[model samples]
Each structure stands twice: as structure tokens, then as C-alpha cells.
Target: MANSKEPRVLAIILGGGKGTRLYPLTKERSKPAVPFGGKYRIVDIPISNCINSGYRKIYLLTQFNSASLHHHITSSYNFDHFSKGFVEILAAEQTLEHSGWFEGTADAVRKNMVHFRSQNPTHYIILSGDQLYRMDLKAFMDSHIASGADITIATTAVNERDATGFGIMKIDNKQAITEFIEKPSVDVLKSGNWKIPANARGDLPAEKEYLASMGIYIFNAKTMEEMLDNEFTDFGKEIIPRAIKNKKVNSYIFDGYWEDIGTIRSFYNSTLDLTLDHPPFNFYDADAPIYTHMRNLPPPKVNGAPHIENSLLTEGCMIINAKSITKSVIGVRTIIREGSELDGVITMGADFYENEEAKADNKKEGRPNIGIGKNCKIAKAIIDKDAAIGDNCSINVSGKVYPDGENKLDNGVSFYSSEGIIVIRKGAVIPSGTVI
Candidate 1:
């Protein structure tokens, strides 16, 4: 049951960025390695898409806190030897010929050209790591082969407010890209540097005036090798613009839920979106499920008839008489004590359980055990892994629209308030009777 006509495609996931926008979260791990949807990492989206699309030979390019990422990939993805399917990570390394870190996205790919070339793929599928969306990549590759394009860029129609944040594309009736602008300003759009005819706009509403690049691309193997020969540092800022003029570049329009998790606000909002009754993006699609490192944990336990609504409670959570929880994502190994309340929160639960001896030691040292404590009220917050909140704590940010500032409380606890969403850093300890 295979499509013999389909080209042998190699998927390359770029996971090397520093993730400066998602700081604090990305402080200890790479952006792709950061947890999402309670139990999955950010890198799982692209990798799962590749596997579901019948493309098994995958390569992940990563740097900067890649140890956890490596562990997750190796432990999660292991194929049978006869299938010749594999998922591998290629970190930035120094060789006799080259001795520097990956300078940019294009550079990261260029440096790892030798490894990719060894796979002998007909076409290359390039994807970003920090985006959340589910797409059938086989259809994208089929469109690329049908178009006979040297390079095909995946595009989505966006309204005026979002046009400036993306690489806008101007395509002819034949789907050939005429011009490409990276993050064009409002004045440029008004000047009519690039325009789309009404007939060629497809299913996009008339209000959505521009086609924005999704940062996903399919390149013919030979064409990519030649393009990488040049001294381009980045794809969006450098290579793609030049390629539009010289090469047979086309566009594949994708009309689906896609969000580039680039900033804290975007990441926060997108993660919280999953708690909606009918989310734009969902993880429950059995036909194409997102895969991650599975843990052998017990089911979540809810005792004392706690009020819960419109929330995702992951495995190994113990909720004992919590007052209420609404619109939140509770991660693995979470423990919510009596009289606690959570609203619009994301608790990234503990990495490990604290045994009785550990709890005793914590009490002796005047520190709270891991997880939330009793009589606490948390609203619009993100509690990172292994955090300990003492009893009678309040982390509500009701009136603030933006962060007034961050503070480092006693016992090495760091608290950051941004866009009125409080973030308690990983392994932080908040003593009793604290309020924010």
C-alpha cells in the first residue's frame, strides 16, 4: 500500500534557534524541546507530520541545549531495522573543513549537506520546529512534483494586521512566484509592490489581501544543493527572495490552523487554545495523532468532587478537593491540594514525584513540597516543572495588562509577569502566605 509514483523525500526539521522570544521557558531547554499540550514537546508536531506522510527518513538539526531533545527523540522514535526508517538529530559540530556553530537556518542546512546527501532523496522537505499545526506533507510534495518547480513554498492567506509579520508572496495565475518580501511594512503593501488577483486568491476571504509564507518549503534535491552553494545566511531574509527571481519557485496554499510559536504571548495563547471546547487545532485526531515520549504513569485522580470544566488533566495528576479549575492545562504528576483554585492556567507538572522522606526534608528546611499547596489561588499563570507553592499563596493578575516587572523571592524563587500571565520558573519555591 505505497505510492510508488511519489518521490523519495527527506524531511529536515530546523531546531537550532536560540528562542530568545520564549525566554525563561527556553532557558534550560531548546525551543523545540520545550513541553507543549501537557505531555508533548514542540518538536513533536513536525516529526509526527513527517511520519504520518510516509516519509520515514528524517533529520533534526539542533543546537543550544539539545541534550534533552536528543534524549527525547532517541527514546521516542525507534523503527524496525527492515523498514529502513529512522529519525536522527544532527547537532552543530566542528570538522576539519568547518569550525563554527550554525549561523542561521540556511547555514544550518548547508553545513549538514553531506549527511542529507547521503540519504539520496529526490526532494527535501524543510520545516520549522517551533510551529503548531497538522498538515499532510504528502499532498504538499505531490503539488511540488506536479508543478515541476525547483522550489515550492507553502503559503497561507493572512489579513492586513498579520501581513507585516510574515514573508509575503506575489504569485501569478500559474502559481509561479513573482515577488517575495520578508516582513513588509504597511507602507510597502499600500504601494502595491505585490498584488494578488481576485480570481487567483482561492478560498481566502476578500479581506485577507496577502499571501504569507508558512516557512515550510519543498526543494528538488539538485536545486537545493546548488542554492546552498551560495553564501546565503538565512532562507527568508536572503535565499528565498533571490530564488524567486532565478528559479522556478511556486506556492502551495494551506488553509488550516497554523501558529508560529515565536513569542511568549503567541505561545501562551496557542497552548491555552487547546482547552477550548472546539479548538482550531486538536490533538485527538486518531488518523494523525501527535506522538511523544510515552511514560508509564497512572491515570489522573480527582477526589472530593472538585469542580472542573473546559480543561485538560494529563496523567498522574492528583486533585484533592480543589475548589474549582476552569480553562487550564494540567500536566503530568500535578498535585493540587484542598481549597486551591486555578483559572486560565498552565501547570507544567512535576518531573518526578516527591516521596515521603523528601516531603519531610522539605518541611524541615522550611520549604514547600513540589506542586501546588492548599488555600492557593492561581489565575492566568504558567507554573513550570517541579515548582513548589506553599500554602495560602495568591498568584492572580486581574487588572494588569502587561508585566509591571519580575521579582526573585526568597528561597531562589523567580516570578515573571508578562501580558498579565504569571510564570513561575522551573523548580522555584514559593513560601507560605505569598501574594502577587
Candidate 2:
């Protein structure tokens, strides 16, 4: 069990990236604010991990399209006035000393140092907002203190194929990082020179592979202050490499499921995995539950016998006589009419429910309601929120791979196709009998 004592830690969650790879889903919201797992946003993962680990003082730094992110944070996390715990949002602002926006991750923290210093914490925990995983950060901080290291980074072992995409580290016998290389080439990894020492891994299965950085770091407050005095922009690209040469940097091995959610395909696969028989990351862990903003909606309604196999249906959904749904995630307040067959799809439920009058008005305006109509077949796609698909529509029919393409209209809905995954943007309307 992790230590239960009050921790003197200030957690900074980097939330500024404009997730271009996520495209239409991130069109209006920041990456961290993007919806995930039917009921939560991507930022909930890290925030919940922090709360679960007993670290309450959190600072979320965001810049692009931060209104939704700000609203989510303000509405979701509320601490008592009598307690010192609070989750605050520190947007990039102009001051007399600095005028530019955050250039990189390190710069984001550097620009917010004044706010961070106000807490007067002994340690600083830096985290990314777009990854999915569960961890007891108290254990991570305890390891750093036990090792007496200036900085400790969370790392995980990666196979050869996945190793090239991460910042590889070479640790000595003492489990201290000796060298750091960010996104090294296949040739560099094949040289057999950057292998981590087997004994240094501490009970983990020894393999002739690299330790990839999880982008979770703990820094002694004073050490972080001194390191940020310079103009290093990124931690992986510059700060960690420099710190390895001068400071005692140790690696805390984390052997668990962690996905960076960097691209659409990766996001699609990881989310659908939740409906599997035995998922890699389970959200039902009562001991460490993923927290999110609660909604007071009625339970899902199934009008007739709908064949649902290995699917997750969230709250406020109405499935009306669907033929079959396999390996899919139906978000909150989603409605599927009669004879609709969906497979391997993620339907992000509507933001607001439309009443009978609204549906009649939509019909008069030749628009479908804010949900799926009758006789639609959707497969291997992502239907964003407030989308209206008319009757007899087929999506991703051919299963073609489109790396990047979109049909976007001015003041209208947009459709993006990536890696054969069709993304119907929020509020998109697909007419009846349409096939794609």
C-alpha cells in the first residue's frame, strides 16, 4: 500500500497541445477535453489518478480551445474551502516579464512557475493529459524519495517494434539513467548498445530491450527550479538528456497498460478494447475507479429484444429493436431505431436530448433527429456527438484505408476518414439511403 501521509507535492498536468492527429474530434475542444470511454474526458484519467494517489493540489495548463477544458475542470473537481486541496486552471497569460505563449511542455511549466511556487511544495509531479492509465503516484514519489534521486521518471519496457517511437533510456547497475535518446532510429536500437542492464530492472523480467519513457516525472522542487532557469523547451528532447549528464536521474519501471492516445486509430482500438472479455485496462476496479463528472440521467431503455454482444451501453440511451450490435460502445443518451445493425463502432451520445416537438420540427426542416434513424448499418467508425444518421445508411462499407481525407463544409458538418476509420463530426447529418 502507498503511504497515507499528506504529501508535499504539486502536480502540473500539461494540457496545451492542439491534437491535430485526432482531427474532427478535437475541432472545437482541446485534446484533454475530448470525450472518452462514453462518459469521461481524456483529462479525467490523469486527474483521477492524482486524486486517487492523494495529491489534491493540481494545476492544469492549457492554451488552445481551452473553454471546454476549463468548464470541465471547474465543474468536475470541487474542493472544500476549509481544505488546502484545489484543482486550478492556469492558462497561458501575458505578463510584464514574458509575453509569448508556452513554446513547449517545459516552457508551459516555466511560464507558470509563479503559480507553482505559491504552493511551496517539496516535489513537483509533471504529467501529460492525453494518456490512459491507472497508477498510484504516491508509490512513484516514495520510490524517488527512497532512491534519494534528484529526478525520477516513470518508464516501461517496450518491444523492438514499439521501442523506436519512444525516448529510450539506458540505466546502470544502480538503476540510474546513464543516457537518454528521444525517438531513436531502428539502426540505433539495433546496435545492441542501449540495452538496460538486467539486474537494474528489480524483479521485472530481464529482456534485451529498451525502457521507454512514460512522460511522467517527479522532480525535487529546488532541482526543477534550477533546471528551468535555462530555456529548454521539452522534457524528453532536452531536459532529461541534460539532467542525465549532471543530476541523479532514476527510472521507476511501470509494468502496466498505458496508451498515449496520439492518433485516431490508436484511440479507436483502445476504446473498443474496453468491451472485450478481458480488457488490458479495466475501469471496474473498485479499489481504483476512474472518476468523472456524474450525470443524473435515467437508465438506458431497450424497447425490444436487441442482440447485443460484447458491447457497452452507457446511461440515458434508447435502443429500439436494433438487429445486432457487436463490439461497440454506445455513449450516453444515444438512440438507435429499429433494424439498425452496428459493429465495431463508437457512437458518442448526444449532448442534449430532443423532445417530440423538436423531432417534429427537425422532420419539417428535412433533418434527422440527434440520433441514429431506422435501418442503418455502421461498422468500424466513430459517430461523434449530436450526429443524425437517417434511415438505410451504410458507413465504412468498403473498409478502405484513407490515411487522411475529409469533406468539410462551411457552417456545416465535417466528415473525416483516417486509416479506414470514418469519423462523423459532431452535429453531422447523413441523409437517408446514403452509403459510404
Maximum-lDDT candidate: 1
Quote the lDDT for 146 in model 2: 93
* Candidate 2, residue 413: lDDT: 43
Candidate 1, after superposition: displacement of residue 8 in Å? 1.3
Q: What would the TM-scores of all predictions be?
A: 0.96, 0.95
> lDDT per residue, candidate 1, 25-65, as tens digits?
88888999988888889999999999999889999999899
Candidate 2, residue 83: lDDT: 63
Where does the lowest 10-residue lDDT sum fall in candidate 2?
A: 405-414
Assess the local accuracy of residue 412 in candidate 2 as a C-alpha lDDT between 0 and 100: 50
- Residue range 46-135, candidate 2, lDDT tens digits: 999999998999999999899988888888889898667888888889999899989999999999999888888999999999998999
User: Which residue pairs in candidate 1 have backbone atoms (N, alpha carbon, C) closer than 3 angstroms, thus clashing?
Assistant: none
List the global CA lDDT of all models: 0.89, 0.88
